[model samples]
Target: MKQKLGNIFGIISIISAVLYAVFFSLSRKQFTETFLVYSLLFLCLYAFYKLSKHAFHVNYRFLSKKWSGRFFNSDVLVLVLAVGVICRLLLLTYTPNLSQDFFRFIWDGNQLLAGYNPYLYLPDEVMRSGASPIPNAAFLHANMGELSSGHYTNYPPLNQLVFAAAAFLGGKSIFATMLWMRIFIIIADVGIFFYGLKLLKLLGKSPYLILLYFLNPFVIIELTGNLHFDGMVSFLLLLSVYHLLKSQQIKTALFLAYGVLLKLLPLIVLPLLFKKLQWKRASLLCLAVGAIVLIGFLPFYSSDLIEKYSGSVALWFGDFEFNASVYYLIRAIGYEFTGYNVIETAGIVLPMITFLSVLLIALKRKNEIPEVLLSSIVFSFFVYLFLSTTVHPWYLTIPLLFSVFTRYRFMLVWSFVVFLSYYTYSNSQFTENLVLVGLEYTVVAAVFLWEVIFFDKNNLQKTKLNSL
Candidate 1:
């Protein structure tokens, strides 16, 4: 009966997920009703799985004990992952028009293809003209209200380059562009997992860690559900770090630069790098890579890269509304901001404080660079969270991913919880307001404090020993 129930739960989970994906794909937007139904289904499945575990007399011990002889192996994990991947592919194929700012990408790509600078025209102007040099109709409609008559795209040209490539291959069909772009993300997802596992193995980690990340709903939903290129950025960052540890310093620097070119945030890791290796070697290598990235990005990219990037980063300070952070205190003070200017200002000042302070402490003690990098990453993520104008659920993944190296189990659990918070914003029934956002941040703050103040020493010791 227990085994049967477990099977039943598994089947239900899969069916409900597929149903949600199918409905979302067809609708072109998430259906509040459908999402609610899917959430209920998942909760029910979770309950059933718990019941099955007890009834089947399955080993209740942790990964320390092997429960079902074959259930924990790589082959089983691979099969489970395959199902997840296939489901994502199916959903991507069916999902209606592009999501979020994908239409902007199409618009920008169209501009680029026509020899018009995307940064020069507002989306409204492009749509008003109705001259689709790129061919996706949805792109025209999506900009109807977004263009304030003078709004230019702030996205860097690299992403637009990818979109242009997809449009070139797929012609004017939105679906075709989505399909090709999504395929790249799908490949990136798989590559991230494979290389992530390789890095863990190199560090002598158990295969369970691989299963944890690969099977994570957060990863599945983010990479597949949203089809974000963040997966590719993540893969490159991890691969670069892996090479760095192997003493392939020059190649590692190049990869890091490449990662930054894909997404600029990875450049933050470079500062931490200079402190890691011999200052001369690290500086030269990083500079060389920076120069290469600039050459690639310079011509098509905006000259106001810093200002534009800062404007985007400025969005974080608009309020203290999201799951957990010191920003709650800031918002509580009743400071009003139209954008994250205050937060951006604070971020600029505060990160320097945290980084310099931590660097001094770590250098004084001669701590391993990995430990410093982990600390820097965590601090940078928090600063971003605290001042960020937009606090998407997946943003938490950046910090949480690095915590794995620190042997921070609490962070893993917190990551899953934060991942689950996707439902909060996702729940179309309830308007996402400060109260709800506050609750989410409250949980995140509690979790962060627990990990930092209470668990840091123990986890660090464990990680140190494991590395040795």
Candidate 2:
């Protein structure tokens, strides 16, 4: 009877996945339709969870043996991954639905291919001047919106290179450009799957644990469907850690640098490596990583690079506030006292706090073991996000990927609730629903606290008992 119920839930999940693809492909711009798609996607995820739970409970030994089998085995693990790949491929045929960020990516890529510095001019300035060097400059400028058009491109150098490759291959068509970008992200995701499985095995965990990341609808939708480069960042990060675990210090340092070049967030993890290596080896790794990062910046190096990039990045702290957790609470308190928004102060102070917190975690945690290092990374990023002024849905990808290695599953819960952040885009005013934001973070925070407090305590007790 339990097996039958599990099978039924699995069928429902598959159907929901297909329906989600259909609706997503048909009307990406319609909020109501998009919401329906998200609803179905979440249902699919929930059903899968139930199916797995019930199946595991019904026949523990059989399910364990089946899931623990090799990659080629005819097991549910293979089936889940196959379904995930199909969902991504189906969405690949459609243009980016969730965000227009890809337009900026294509625009930057075009600028690079045309031998122009993407950082040198704002899109609005270039369009207004009518002397834009990029092909289809007018079209790209119009689509990227005033907010993005007014800011200097702040994407890191390696990201620009990926953009350039896509633009060179896709030419002037938006669909073609999106296709190329999706292909890169999908390939990167495949790399993540390969290394994720290997790392799981090396850590003495079930390889099936990889499905938490690889089969995650949030990852599939955000990275593949929306064309966010966080997927590449996740891939490089996992590969770097895999190499680190294997004691390949040079390869680890090189890949870590590459990950940093893709997204600056990875720089926070450098301190965590200190406890994992000897002082001399750590210094050399740091120097090598620094040199590689500097090399990536050499092409776009200029007197104004620092000024422009810093200015653009500063807007996130001072000017923008969205779906923040602890920062929002602080902002409220400040506003109650000052009769004005206090983001300016909170922005500066919170980042310093986050930096200090990450440093503390790195210094305090025993990161020599792979599992401990992964947990540290997860905790550090959690601190970063909790204190951030802007917690975009895709930003959760880092912690989500890392959490699969640790016993904590709170990040998975965050991934599901993080979709609520997209509710902001449902209206033309771009008005935020603070209630939804609160609910999202509240649930995530509750789960996080439960894991860190109750779950960890119970696990510690079990460990002590087993040792006895």
Candidate 3:
């Protein structure tokens, strides 16, 4: 009877997931609809969780031998992955409902395809001067927003290559460009699933755990549905770590460098690796990483490239504030004291603190082992996000991916709650509900603190027992 009930719920969950994808794909493109769609999506996810917990418990022995074997079979894994892929494919038919960033991506790619340097001209400047070189320049400029159009692009070189590929294939069709980008992202996601499963096996954990990331609704919607390249970035980071654990230092360095070129966030993890290798090999690794990054930049290298890129990056620290936590509190305090917003001071101080926190984690932790190193990287990323002036929902994807290798599940919890930040998009005014933002961070921080304290206590007890 129990087994029957579980299977029933499992079927319902799958149906619900598919229905959610269909509704999401067909819904009107507005942020106001997000709450309803996301709520239903979460309900389906919860039902799936209950199905797995109650019906598929490892110790449940009510099933026949054949059925039980089937439950744990490799075929089931393939089926689950196939379902995820189908959901993404369904979403691919619709325009991105959540983000306009893809417009900038297509625009930049068009620039590259036309032999123009994207970094040399801001979208507004190109459009205003009537000197735009890219096809569909007006459409992209109108959609990418004033903030994006005013700034030189900050996408790294490797990411530009991907964009260029999309442009070359997409030509004048926005849908075609988006489709190509989504295809690339989906391919990268497939790589992550396989590599993540292997990494889990290496850690002596259940390979099924990879499904948590691979089948995650957030991963599906944000990466494949919205065409975010963070999915590719996550895969490269995981591949690098996997190679590192296998003692393939050169391959590890190369993958890490590629990941850094895709998204600069992986650079923070480099310091944590110092203690994992001898000084001589560590020096070589650093040199190799530097050479790879330099090579990536060679084609675009010019005096203005540095200025434009660095200036664009500095805006994140100096100007932007969104879905923040510790930085918000400090900013609030500054506002109360000074009678004005003080992002200028808070931004600078917060990032400096984050830098010192990551440096300390690198120096203080015993990261010679793979698990220890991964945990430190996760912690460092958490600190950086906690201190960041902006915490986009997709940014949590980084720490969430890293946490899969460690004992931490706070980042998993974060993946769900981060969706609340999208409420800011409910209207064009872009007004944020501080109350919702506060609620989101409060829950995430509570989970993080609980896990940190309890995980450390458990580790200390294990250390003591081992010593005896």
Candidate 4:
């Protein structure tokens, strides 16, 4: 029996190591390739299933030692860290296949080094006007895709700082710059692991739950494998939360300042901090975070910054629509009735609704404890995501991180199936298959209801919602 279990563990380790390569090398072009992507997703899901089950059933009996704490086994903790590091390091130099966002990342970095605020320059205009040129202007502009080339960059100032460093250090080599960016993201993931461990310990959940964030293949592919700086934002957000839990308001404000400057998701959860600290302190923290964000924007401060940034963000809510759930359903209704897209209207209303919903969550919940605090925050994000017009796969990582502290496993289900959205890129036109999108969300909704509603003390097995 022990031999069989040990062999299962060995097989899991080997399979995960091998698949990390396949995941890194995957190309997104669809025709004649759907089967491979689906197969890879299936195998990855299987790995998650087996590891989660093994972690629970054996309860780390195999990794535990006399000196280990009642909750976490340090040996298993090392195993989790090793897997995350090895998987990411293997993809360090590979070009991102599943996303072209990295091209824009490289372009932004090089643009910053060219004595221009990346936020202010439209890449397409640079090529057309022949302005102070970025080296390899044609190559970067061409590869960054028309949509990105035509738009003013929405990436915040702190992110641009990292890009400028990569550009400075990497010289003219795109791949070299990509290497530096990947290194930065890998370091951020390591921070996520460390702070995540401290959080799980503080919350009194299984420390192994960090695997849900670090070991998940989708996280590896989207954040590390595809060179998205959402990884960096997530790390800072985790650090901020850890400080908040420790009652270090000044430290929390500083970390959150950088996090919100990198991306807006951290700011979305800011009100939740009110649940942890007193009213006066929380107000001060909010002001501090805001002041820092304004200071961060000051260097790149342009008359166009606020207007251009808000317009760019407005595109996601009104102009852009992809892999959305409720928004799609609403859009279809509008098309049937008004014979036009309702995104302009829906975008205006949905965000208003999401704001009130999240505010209600933070105010109504007793969240001094990590479990409730994170649970309310994750659920608020669920409301936000379900109503969002654009739900990228990487967007799920924050909720997935928080859900670990609570009993919710819906984010786990969403992560596995979210890969289905990549099928949109299979054709050149970038059209999502509504059927596949339907299948994906139906599974998600079912699992969500099961975990949140149906599962209880006498019915833990009800999580056959396919989570563990």
Please report, in order, the local distance difference test score of every candidate based on alpha carbons: 0.58, 0.84, 0.82, 0.82
**TM-score quality measure for candidate 2:** 0.92
Please give the lDDT score for candidate 4.
Answer: 0.82
Query: What TM-scores do the predictions have?
Result: 0.76, 0.92, 0.91, 0.91
Q: How does residue 241 of candidate 3 score in lDDT?
A: 87
Model 1 worst lDDT window (10 residues)? 56-65
Q: Which stretches of candidate 4 lie over 4 Å from their true place?
A: 1-7, 31-72, 456-468
**Model 1 C-alpha lDDT versus the unseen true structure:** 0.58
- Best prediction by lDDT: 2
List the candidate 2 regions with Cα displacement exceeding 4 Å.
1-16, 23-33, 49-74
Better of 1 and 4 by lDDT: 4
Q: What digit string (tens of lDDT, one per residue) describes model 1 on residues 309-395?
A: 545444443323345345445545435654333554554555566556545543553334565566566566565555544556556
Native-structure RMSD, model 1: 6.2
Per-residue alpha-carbon lDDT of model 3 for 1-468, expressed as tens digits? 766764765576577567656656643335556656666776666655554544434544444666655644443455456666777777777777677899999999999888988888888888878988788889889999888989999999999999999988888888898899999999998898778878988888765566677767788888887779999998998988889889999899999999999989999888888888867887789889989999998899888999999999989988988899988888888888998888988878888898999989988889888888989988999999989999888887777887888888888888888888887877568888899999998998899888899777889999999999
Best by TM-score: 2
Using TM-score as the yardstick, the better of models 1 and 3 is 3
Q: Which regions of candidate 1 fall more than 4 Å away from where they truly are?
A: 1-73, 96-99, 128-132, 137-150, 301-325, 334-376, 409-431, 457-468
Clash pairs, candidate 3, are: none
Model 2 weakest lDDT span, ten residues long: 54-63
